[model samples]
Target: MGQQKTKKIEKEEPIKEEVKKPAEKIEEKKPEVKPAAKPKKAKAPRVRGQKWTAAKEKIGQKDYVIEEAIELAKSTNNAKFDASVEVHINFQLAKKSKEPIRGMVKLPHGTGKKLNVAIADDKLIEEITKTKKTPFDVLLAKTEDLAKLTKIAKILGPKGLMPSEKSGTLTADPKKTLEELNKGKISYKTDQFGILHQILGKISWDDKKLVENYQTMLSV
Candidate 1:
């Protein structure tokens, strides 16, 4: 009986060893966890005018022309303006149109700079003083006087403020002219190709203001 018991105990030991081996193998095969991935940083967009290619792209994409361009200018958000500004317009008039379709508007917003106005007639000056109770920045007695006109030409010519007979702003009718002036009617001249050009105002205005001015120019 003792010998039979010894053999049975030896067989049971082998079964226990087999179970321990499987547990150790399971622990060795277990995988280690890795860290999570981080997000990448985004790049900033390029600024306008920084590159020649960007400038060309901007100009090419712009669609505003003539009065619409003026309106866009008025709508700009810039708060300050230079003493003088130059504006250009391209207009296509009907071939047979008898009346002049191009003119300038001074705008109630002013030119974003001080202006020296020269009036030809004494009566107009008197009326401006009497009714408006104000004197113009500068005045010229002879509208056609080349010498007097030449003196101020250097100052006003490049600035686009010099009065010309072609613009129709220099007229005998002070009351009518002043009425328009108060209502934002100024003057404008045309290029060699009959395209109207004038300084509307500063570039600091908002988009809506520019659009209004542009529409007014178109209507005129």
Candidate 2:
């Protein structure tokens, strides 16, 4: 009886050892965790219109004044069609301005491009909504019609076609404004980037005409 009990105890010890071996093997086979990879930064899109690269480089880095810039700009216009001359002025306004400087001026010479004008009314509002595109370059509105056109503000605002009180496009009296606009008049305002850009004249015009037009814009 003693010898049988001894044999049974020895067999139970080996069985227990066999059961623990699998658990030890599972722990040894566990996978090692690695740190996550970082995301790559996005690159800015390249600017379009490579045709003006050489022309712009030729203008050089020198700070040319109004007169010298006009001549240089005229000389550099190598487009097949006549390029329009523009007067762009940088203002010292802060990024978050309480009272932004905005003004309208009547240039002696008109913008070379013919602009389609429209008076804002119920009929015109219906006409504009009927089409996907708004056909007019300038929109004139009175006090009564101004609130009515708010529905279409999203459409016209981005195109810079939305008439505002500050720009004098939205007015109680549009007749005088129309006459002034017909006589080479335009509005100039400092943009969000603090730059005022206005169409001065065409490159085909005489340098004298450009200078005079630029001076008129400067006066405004």
Candidate 3:
């Protein structure tokens, strides 16, 4: 009986040790299982065209000539349509020199539409009237006479003929102004943000016409 009891006790002790060893191993392995790392976020792609808001913000209170402005428009792909050179001259008195600077130029290709001009002088009005079958739609003696002129501000303003000081159209030189009108000279003002917008010429215009118009604008 004593020999049997000793053998049984030894077996029981071995079984207990085996169970304890497995439990210890399970506890030790728990801390080694870490959480997986998260993936990084992707960045957005840049837009191809320039932002109008951004351009306006950058041009504030700065005086940019028609030539510089045209170059910028071409390079940035902002303003390219008809032969129109729009510029934003600085608001400073010094920047507004007494000498007349050319404000806008139009190509022979036309702006793809007829221009409606209101002449401040009766002589110019009669001269424009003789071209009754010409491409122009309207010709008047007073600026305030045409309601349509005021109505088409968006179309004409960007085309640089809103009669504002910025456009140089509100002038006393009837002959010179009429000549420019016939030649497709328009003007536009920079908004509060100082960004001036205008067309140069149609894509169909020849290199010579483009160069001539470009030179004319630069001289202004």
Candidate 4:
């Protein structure tokens, strides 16, 4: 018998397939935060002028008589122009009192101001509306013109020029009111701060005249 040649088949290894994997997700970086800044320092207060300081030194802590005060005011005045002599009176009224402190004063010598006066008539109202100009400082109205003034109340009211019975600007006789105004009949009232401010006259006026006006205003 011939030797049997058995063919042995080698076992082939299974083919290894290279499987692809999913990519990893990337993370985003956050922004950096900063601390708050400090506040700036405040500026120093203003310093008064040498002239003003010199003048201030003249006034004392003690209350001065009216005459001395007026003289001191005149002496302290550094202005070259003839400045007005102003008066300010503070009132200690009962807070509960509802009455308003207001009245008209006919100064012996007029308040150096030359007020442009106007009559609040139908024609004046039309002219003011047409021109869009309020050339007058004072407005006097008659009973007949009171109705016409309503058309321009928004115009005159805010300017403190509106005519009213309480203000003594509304009257039956316009002529009399004009004369009184020309004669320096000025109105005054306690301000919201409970102080009354008025001008006596120009400093150039005689001390005697200033004193008289001051006395008259004090009397009221």
User: Highest TM-score, which number?
Assistant: 4
Candidate number that wins on TM-score, 1 or 4: 4
TM-score of 1: 0.42
By TM-score: ranked, best first: 4, 2, 1, 3
TM-score of each: 0.42, 0.70, 0.32, 0.76
List, residue by residue over 76-168, the lDDT tens digit for candidate 3.
445555444332334433344554333545555444345666654444434434542322333322344344345444544454344544355
What are the C-alpha RMSDs, in order, of all predicted structures? 25.4, 9.4, 19.8, 10.5
Q: Among these predicted structures, which one has the highest lDDT?
A: 4
The lDDT values for all models are 0.52, 0.79, 0.48, 0.85
Q: Which ten residues in a row have the lowest lDDT in candidate 1?
A: 76-85
- For model 2, how does the per-residue alpha-carbon lDDT over 13-102 read when each residue is reduced to its tens digit? 544444444544445566878888898888888785665887778887889777888888877787788889987878778877856567
Candidate order by lDDT, decreasing, is 4, 2, 1, 3
Alpha carbon lDDT of residue 184, candidate 1?
60
Better of 2 and 3 by lDDT: 2
lDDT of 1 by residue, 1-220 (tens): 4555434444445444444445444456668677877877788897554455543554465666655655443344233534233455567666665455545565655454455455544455445435643345433333444444454455555554455556654455545665556556666556556677655555655545555565566666
Tell me the spans in candidate 4 whose CA falls farther than 4 Å from its real position. 1-44, 96-99, 130-132
